[model samples]
Target: MKAATAVAVVVAVAVTLGMVATLAEAGDNNRVFQPCADAKIQRGDGFTFGIAFSTRESFFFNQTQLSPCDRRLSLASGANAQLALFRPKVDEISLLTVNTTSYPAVTNGGFMVAFAGRKYAARSLPAFVSNSSYTVTSFTLVLEFQKGTLQNLYWKRDGCASCSGKSNFVCLNKQECAIKTSNCKSANQGGSVDCSIGIQLAFSGTDKHDAVLNSWYEVSNLQQYSLYGLYSNLRNSLTSQYNKIF
Candidate 1:
């Protein structure tokens, strides 16, 4: 009888922990997406950002498809668009590279924007990720923080460094390095190009303790983090265990 009670208690603990994990995942998922104009950031908290992109004409709330910095974008039916969500620490430097996962493909003449925090936080400019002619794959983002609060998010151009000397890429106006849309997987019937975007992230300004921070040097020292793979493995493991237990 004593052994039986111990087994039961163990199972109860496992179930409770599982439930808590699920709740945490729920909060971290897409629900974190908030309008850049209304996002709120606080010190010692995770900031999940949203980047909406699409190739369709009507996906945007307006004809211009202004950057998230300027207006709120509406994701409606027949929009044929997708939003890529990610969270990175503002107090540290990191490298993030993401490819199309379960989300719809980003194709033909699409722009994207980054948004975080409320009132005091600023969103990035509307960046052209892909066009009918080309698609950009490498980018550097700078997140400015003041007194532990997020201030602004912006993209730092690399002067075509990623595109130079590559046969598949073209240097546009000596500022952007991009590949022909015909080589992108979605646009080309037999193309092998992966339109993955690499974000080299850096942080500037001070933290809550008023200590200056620079993410550039730190990010340069570490390898890229693959959050997608970690999430997938965890979810799959949980699901497998759940099915076996129940």
Candidate 2:
């Protein structure tokens, strides 16, 4: 009887430890993917642009979640969402120079602010490339605010293999075309293209909130213009501004 009781006690202790370990693992995962809950915006505050590769056609649409643009773009914790305007070749033209009169206002606590048009790039390259075609396939930009502490910023880009109505013909990035011989056969198919970047915002006002904005652009060909380079320049400029403001 004594031996059985000792075995039972040992088993119970092991089971409790195992449960604790499982809970700890779950907590760690949550911390890593923390969902943005408090992020909100008014309807006209957010806009999206979609472009078709074949026809080089584009269309703009505004979010229809009613006024106050209280829709949430991200469910991940510790994140906020806003609309941004992205220009690929920013060095040639300044984002700040654009007319703000056309921009829509974003409301916060009865205060409205316009979504500033900004530049973003994935990497750095020459400001100009001769004898190359420049086309803007698709573009998306976002602005977000995080209350309290500022943390790391993240961005992602996804591509469709049949974007151009051809199988595996449209390469999203320069690396994708280089990897496959078939993809590189045509200049339109395999060119280093498609890039994105994110910027961290500085803390201001009584809100104690930090802002972040990210932009992504898709080009059918990378050899034409260095979209990544343009994006990089924009990122650097915005980062400098945040440094100065914060």
Candidate 3:
């Protein structure tokens, strides 16, 4: 791939998979798209966030098709939640849970992004993951900020799906830096969301979700408490709910 094209692939992957938009990807570019309309949305409703059993991030990567975010994160968030609730464990294993239906699965017991299983509600609560056997050792509960009309999302991946390893080869020269990205695609199609007008505004803001994954791996960052930065939004929600009851 050429330099700019290579950069686009990287940024595009980051755009779809990682929640936060890499500063490099948010260049002097813009997307001119015809707004999406939905059956549940009233004509006057400027932005429509279609809720369902779950969200599939697969189409998010198809920049050409017009799905927001990619098969990366938000797509997996819904199915991960289902896995958390159904088997509600945290151990590691093989089968990766993904969404089978589009976002409109709201009527059904949350769409089965992947696998045939039970259902759950997507309350404004935080996100979490568990083992197929039953445990919460590494539970990741992300609280959504319903503050913005824009739909921010969470995605999940099966720990045992065999993630690609980062192989740092000994490249003798700079010209040999043609390393390939994971280039994974979401395993779904169709279903569209009607986002409101305000827009993330900046197109590419700090809302990137790589922080969520990094936290999962127990990495450190410029923020003080790990929860303070990437998870502040979710932690606050937990605190608010706690204060209300106790």
By TM-score, the best candidate is 1
Best by lDDT: 1
Give one digit per residue, the lDDT tens place, for model 1 in 1-246: 111111111111011111211223323323334444343334333456555555444334546544433324444322445555555544444445445322325433376666555456466776778766777766667787777667777887657654457676788778777776666554343345545565656777776668777655565454332222333342332212222322
Q: Which model, 1 or 3, shows the larger lDDT?
A: 1
Model 1 alpha-carbon drift over 4 Å, by segment: 1-45, 55-78, 101-104, 217-246
Query: What TM-score does candidate 2 get on C-alpha atoms?
Result: 0.20
Alpha-carbon shift of residue 239 in model 2 (angstroms) = 34
Q: Candidate 1 or 2, higher TM-score?
A: 1
lDDT of 2 by residue, 162-217 (tens): 23343323354531111222211123334332211122111111112223222212
lDDT of 1: 0.50
Better of 1 and 2 by lDDT: 1
User: What value does the lDDT take at residue 230 in candidate 1?
Assistant: 38
